[model samples]
Target: MLPALSEKELDRLEDLLITYGNDYSVLNLAELNGFFTALASSPNRVNPEQWLPAVAGGKVPKFKKPAHEEAYTALMLRYASQVAEELADDPEHFEPLFEQSEGEEGPTIILEEWCFGYMRGTQVAEWSELPPEQDRLLKAISLHGLEDNFELLDSMSFDEHQACVPLVVEAAQGLYQYQKQHRH
Candidate 1:
């Protein structure tokens, strides 16, 4: 189990998963949800494999390529852990606005809508106002989509982070369309 993560961190991780899963039909829904749930319960290390079925709960979607699924899951968890590590310095002041929708279809809708809002907020708000990791994630999400853009080991900057708002927004919209067309 992992400790609770901020809303921004979770959103960023979701954006990355969505982008990486762009090539696959089912998206990294289970992985993302499981990661968050695990984090909420305990901040211990998260193993993507162990977490997958728990997150998917047997309804896991099959991707066109097995490698894609593995890759997406790995990247999503890796980045999420990275976010948690960076923010660990601030424990008392982190929680972001969260609204978990209900039912089997709830996660899909929540993910799509939240990503959309995150991107929009990044744009309307000042760069300095956004978190450093968020800005980088947004920029990466904007240019290459979060999937292709985020380099797990790379360092991020505040400026690059702030500039990612539009990119994140664009990526979120793309994801929304994908989800809409592939209703669960």
Candidate 2:
């Protein structure tokens, strides 16, 4: 099994992403986690050739050194593999890397970026026309991730959105199991 990314490595990856300079298009760490989780759960394999460019906001970054580029790419591939292994071996304990912010009440869990990343992954994987049951499972992530659902989400109170977090997690795990059982 590939080693998990250390905190320092993770930070370095984040820095590399930040250096990409297209804030609107580039994904952050949380989004990358969600994106990778979706790809990991996908029934059809999505190669690095397809997904790696998306990591850099739809363009491959031109690193200063060939070694630096190789290192970051290797790190990303390893992280993606780590996500897949965790979901396959221990879906129950799999966790999405959501952000936490201190709200007036307390620390608030933010699922937006992660969810958005996941939805993007689905798009990249071309996961279209799933069965109703599977579509339902995907919806759990979409509710929190998609821009189209913002109005609906806006209608929900903070507590309500907070309550839905577990549902999203469960949905991701369920999707992984479904794909595992029904892989083509």
Model 2 per-residue lDDT tens digits across residues 1-184: 8998999988887877777637545457888889999998887889999998887778788789887798878888888887888888899888888989999869899989899989988888888677898899899999988899999998998899899899889988888888877666
Q: Residue 133 deviation, candidate 1, in Å?
A: 32
Q: Across residues 11-129, which tens digit of lDDT does each residue of candidate 1 receive?
A: 65455455544332223433343234224223134344544443333334466778766655665565456534533444334332233445443331123323333332232222232
Clashing pairs in 2: none
- Per-candidate Cα lDDT values, in order, are 0.40, 0.85
Which model scores highest in lDDT? 2
What are the RMSDs of all candidates, in order? 17.0, 1.5
Query: Alpha-carbon error at 79 in model 2, in Å?
Result: 0.8
How much does candidate 1 score in TM-score? 0.32
Which stretches of candidate 1 lie above 4 Å from their native place?
Answer: 1-46, 97-184
TM-score of 2: 0.93
